[model samples]
Target chain A: MHSLKDRTAIIGVGATPQGKLPGSTQLSLAVDAFKAALDDSGLEKDDIDGLLTFPGTTAPEGPLNYLRVGEALGIDPAFTGSMAMGGGTAGALVQMAAMAVESGHATAVACVFGDAAKTGGSRFNRASGWGDSWGIWGMMGAAANSAVAASRHMALYGTTSEQLAEVAVACRRHASMNPNAVMRDPITIADHQASRFIVEPLHLLDCCLISDGGVCIIVTSAERAKDAKQPRVLISGMGQAYTTRTLEREDWWYVPHQKEALDRAYAMAGLGPQHIDVAQLYDNFTISVLLWLEHAGFCKPGESGPFVEGGRIQLGGELPVNTAGGNLSESYMEGWLHIVEGVRQLRGQGGERQVQGAETCLVTGRGMTLNCSNAMVLTKGEA
Target chain B: MSDHPKPLPEISDETRPFWDGTRNQQLVMQQCARCRHIRYPISRVCPECLEVGHEWVPLSGRGEVYSAIVFHQVYDKAFADDVPYNVSLVQLDEGPRMFSNVVGVPPSQVRVGDRVRVVFDPVTEEVTLPRFTPEDS
Candidate 1:
């Protein structure tokens, strides 16, 4: 398998203030985050020769497309493209950027993702027209789709609502420490249980926050990263896989593609789950993290319920999963924040939630209904 | 009753047969004539053999509930009155899976591995939805 290990580095990360930005458009939020990322990297707009973005409101059709974003940032890039792998695009973006730079296509790449879901309303709600004829019209929301997977997990593995609630509580606890977190008020397992059910087996608390926010990261060759303003984090490994059948498979709850992606990523990084100092697994829904934990080999299948019990995923615990609050409690940048948090931890910039001597961190992105998945391993680069 | 305000599927040349079969109260899938593979959502070419020749074959419509969920939140006002309806992924004994609502039983009672059979629900005059109910029902 081809490897991009240590060939590229993430030198900067940025985010717009998270949560209900009443009047902000996705483009404004994206531009704000993009400028900040450039500043954080100590690179001018001219230095960025590549651009990467996600589809939908931010795609080329929308105002935040690569051409528009480049125009706003005064950049003429050698490579510009959009990836539409849903939430998994962020991790995939880093890999794309690394490959582009490694092959001399471009030197610097900026990957940005943002949305104004709260202020602009959810495009997902209106854009699901195709689902109508597909027989999933009324049942295609992320929460509803994931609920099916969660319900199956409960029936097959005896995973309980209580175990799922633990994920929400742990993410909330981490969010309370991060100033930019949207749902900062700490929540308890009791609180999670008390929350109303959106879909059976998935309480309202188990769902991720749909807020208005943007996140961006700057990727460049390791040599160019030497002069970066902040501590550089090497993009040591990355991999992506997709389940073509999606929820149509008989064993939909078991996400085989996630394991495949993780295995390839681990092989590329030359490390295993045991060597990961911290984890920023995607938590679009609480059950997502549970599935990821098991599939990523943190624990045996059917044992994640017990493994995550008693705050084991909290900041000071065994793995410290989602130390920057994750999509559940932190701002939901559609998995973009997970990569940022991973970079922060590797850079030793995680202030209050910093893991003592964190070196290598694992970050993952689980896209629409568990169809697309991507994983990346990042480590602190030599200063 | 008012129609479901949720967005409906736009019937196209590729998807027309599938929708037409549902309207006739039958579950149909595109079976690749070349590779003999069954496909869903009605595609133009066979994913397996990349062959365009296919036949719309009626399925048994008998399957087990692979997974299920009850929607408590009203994502659209069309579904407001139907708060707390169960949606399930039925893995057809014929080998293709479909997303449909499971009725004829309490939403909370639906469980994985429950035997189910497809039933058609005529919503709009032009659209008939394929739903599922407990096999025993």
Candidate 2:
């Protein structure tokens, strides 16, 4: 029950140019984002005392391990580790950074996620090694796992394809205003329906873009953040939860642990879903956004279909989600950019798609076929 | 199906019995002797009761399709020829779930909650995979 409320603040956020960087390795991209974050925070590389990263890199040629990353960056940190929780690494990184800073383990931490899946080829697309034991076929990709969840939702709650399409349309609309987004063209529900199925119930459009990119966020004690260049975004509250079993778990559609994580986050933040001005919920697939909305208590269990309709999740609507475009339309950095976008929105740096006077932003990360998840609530300087 | 180059499962000490049962045309699961709980994707210990003592119980091989998906994209070159395959989760009658393919019907035609029964395909001399087909098929 120890609270992480306002103990640490994100002083800088940075990313490598989001599309395919043909010549860059994952380590180099990590360095690029780390350097940019340092520059943005007006802190020297020497200021960083801790390092964290995600071990699930799509790049086949580079070492994404934290020790190797530290060797590459020339920073021997006082505290260093890598999280292997897949997409949930982003929120987990922030939570760990806050704990490291708050408990006097480290003064400043640099958390980065980098991948060159587009250029190096996606090693994760194949079914081998660990998947063999579970009897998961090679053809069953991540989309297939999510499609099963979507199919269950449709069967139980009568969630329609049109309702799922709204999520894609709204995200693309938001991406249209974001220069960094890879797919900025405004797509309608018709376009979504017309898109070919990657997995039935999940069109190619419904899936997130595969791009080569890197994003980094710098965290420091709230007191040290006062002297940083940009407006500080406090890591007010955070939570992480995981299921013991993954895809074959009984409650596949509901994602019980994700709800627990969000409830813990909301409780620590002393706020409800109604207080969130914007959300950057992880959208590995369009259906994931709807599931997150429902499980996070933004809407009732079966009401997500109606809750997201009529532009409610758009920029001018009730809760503008994925304001910088999520993994769906924006550049995919394995949910790392979701955290960067949350920080940007809180700092009032979201250029054309900025939610006006946004005070509180909720960011989330989901991984391992929705079985593992983390949620964090961030606010702008004691707002 | 002869030309399909799909990757096969890697059987281990824990999972060998499950695969061995499929070879004999029986669907088996690990049931805890302590709690009478059945589990799939074989594990060393019972998740429910944390008991190392267990038994390999043959199930009725009948269940309902909890959910299904048709994959149109080729994730691996081995599956390039099998572009539109169905992958499904079957909730067994004994309270366990398994990752499998629903065969004997078009992938897109499969629906959630449809009754399914286990069917074995002995692809290689050493391995036999368990798949599902409609109960009445």
Candidate 3:
């Protein structure tokens, strides 16, 4: 009853195809994703009165200003700001959209984000070089950090190389059913084991795909949401939490305060773990799915190997996760495709692998240094 | 995390003791004397008690290999030549994990719960990195 049941609704969701777009510039994809979202809502670029994005992304503050998305479209935003939480930025973007509507600062808030990570490149970093930060190790990307966490998980639970292979195989199976996924071809455990090892305890298949894709959504007051193409997907609760940006903060890469962030979202929504019908978990790496699954209460800590290895997270499982193939099989941009997949499931538009009568979803983002995360709870919306 | 001729960490008044302690080879965990609770990463106040009385205490140098990662990919141009180096977090028995590199072992040999001890690599006249070596060694 405390949720945003009738408070605000996500009227439209839009995205570019999930794959490498060689010819596209970051700005064009950002603009196109926004244009498509508005079109889906039967609104215009002019209808957006607020904007949200990331500073570390390819389409920084300039692209929106250069295109004059506001002035050319005639909408003036009363609220505007950029966000940074590494992979957690997507859920934060959606949460900001809901807050904007709830506060009455803007009637229409468009939480727009898109990156040409595959086309351009991702320029993200961890640690501010504060006392004892490990910037000296010179890890350029997230691979090494995740590999470290994965190695620990393996050491603790006797996790095998084949078990991790199961992660990629399941993701590809789900992707094969999803026409939007990039790596739809089914891979065997042998193939995963044979795949190159980028980092110890982490093979090439265990990492996320680098591709250019953009996803955007428009949120508004429920009263006005009646006119949109889909029912109002009410924004229930949204939250974020960081344990420590530096990996050293946790005994392992596993953080203790993670539950509070998800708890805040669930509390605000008047829902619990059991209420979630599907999970669009952020998978910047395969181990993230394992760690986040346990961290998010789908399983116990250190139990993801048993949880996912059961194939329950795949098709016809109790709670469907990563239905758009996730970052594993889809494009990796803070799990943007997960948001789109959430919308698709709520709309019953998911074709073969659709969760039967799926309405509610829990989306989470993982894969920063440590103790950094974003989470949200969404529903099928009201018609 | 760096070994290049690049900028090194200049110890300020607040954190001078921490860097100095690493060089001299005695394990240190910062604590707020007033609250009797531990603090780490050289903060001004006790994260537990919110008290500003911080002091360093020597430790036993024994800890579990909470986790480790062997970096086969190099991000920095200066040290890209050093691939497959190991970076790990060792949870000191006294509490508080210090970001460090696990050395004296092959990258494939590193594992969680493997006993480790602190070892320092001299940085400059004033600083030495507290790297880790397997306790068995």
Candidate 4:
């Protein structure tokens, strides 16, 4: 048996009301969400013996670290650390928490994330210099990186702007059904096209919201999960892959590593794309979802543009993606919310946006110059 | 001294020679002595063969636009006047890619697969930013 398959389960998932919550510090939001997860799991604060965090990129004070967040939460965890893989951190942290519990390092591990990019006056604009000479050319922000990839996808595969619009429209339509979603007013393909371009091939609508939010998921052994308040969402499979080289590589934009990650995850779960009832793909940009759809083996390479058309990926479609509106519509917790939404869907708690009879879900994340990618397979606990 | 408002590349010991090549109106990169692999954004060890010994070799200064994106919003005030400017990735002839602007045309005119050649802009006394122009331009 795969070491990670069904060894640990997510007992609780909590997300504070997302969007411009003024005066909410990262630490405070993290604590609030942590407490909420504790309440949701019917577990006391004393039950958490491990804490894992993914530091936010745009904290008002400083990027979140485990020591500061752990101290504020008043938990002296036996296993505690933070991972920085950009959007990949949340899924990776959950996997870390699962491994920690499966190895008996801790009874329960809480992976928490909080960001104040919206309230803290972050525009998500900064130059990236990983020993590269990109800043001099005015390449700034995460959007530009993905925009270049979108442009390449369009060039290599004949992907059209209208096809990209379908992603924005679907996410907006799903967001309209989610009351907690920040941008709930429905938008159309025309709206996406009419919106001003942040980067060519990507519009304002295609990019994700910059909002303040916090999310927490508590992981414990499958034995403990059986006694939890909420139904258990088992972590069946987890895989992560990364690109070592960026601009120098010939196929940097193609992101071939993402498929490798998902393949590993699927192999561990003994499942494939045909089994995923819902997906909470990281939507840092609409193109990201398209890439993930292809990478996760839903369709062939360059077929994502067409696969997303005709409402195939929206709620009630063949594979419902971003059931909680994703980062595009749901408040951007930097892929942390994807895990929350995946857990919620598997738990059958997606009040309005539930995928009917959802038994399995695929949650994916990619970040940091579009190099790191991760995928997780979550399934409903046996009845 | 140049009064360039935009962020400039930080020169390091590993990248000094490449910048020096740019200052001399040439596009040069480290070619691994053992593997003959040319590397960009300058590295001490060759990524392919882990070769420490290398020679700075001049490139053909020709390539095609692999991909490009035009920035419509001014994320930084330094680039405020350059809104809608293009930041393109050019795949050079010798098999290295670079982040450079395809100049001598409208940002919208830059397209993938467009043939381009390098041009040096002496942004400062110490730095010369390498940009590209359509070969036929």
Model 2: residue A358 alpha-carbon error in angstroms:
0.6
lDDT tens digits, residue span A114-145, model 3: 67777676544443336555665443456766
Better of 2 and 4 by DockQ: 4
Looking at model 2 chain A, which ten-residue stretch has the lowest summed lDDT?
A: A126-135
* Descending-TM-score candidate ranking: 4, 2, 1, 3
Per-residue CA lDDT of candidate 2, range B17-82, in tens? 888998999988888899888866577788777898999999999999998888888776666776
lDDT of 3 at A106: 82
* Candidate 3, residue A52: lDDT: 72
CAPRI level of candidate 2: medium
- The candidates' interface RMSDs, in order, read 2.4, 2.3, 2.8, 1.2
- Candidate 1 scores a chain A TM-score of 0.95
How does the DockQ of candidate 1 come out?
A: 0.59
lDDT of 2 by residue, A1-383 (tens): 67888888999889999887899777778889998899999988899999998755653433448877888899999998887777888888888988999999999999987888788777456341253543345445677777878988988899999999999999999999999899988999999999999888899888998888888999999999986789889888888888757544689556789888999899889988989999999999988899899888899997898889999999999999998889898987878999999999999999999999999999999887566799999999953
Sorted on DockQ, best first, the list reads 4, 2, 1, 3
Model 3 ranges with Cα > 4 A deviation? A60-74, A123-129, A137-140, A245-252, B1-7, B123-126
lDDT value for model 3: 0.73
If candidate 2 were superposed on the true structure by all CA atoms, what would the RMSD be?
A: 2.0
- For all candidates, the clash counts are 0, 0, 8, 0
- Residue A78, model 1: lDDT of 96
> What overall lDDT goes with each candidate model?
0.84, 0.84, 0.73, 0.88
Candidate 3 chain A: 10-residue stretch with minimal lDDT: A63-72
Which residue segments of model 4 deviate by more than 4 Å? A58-64, B1-4
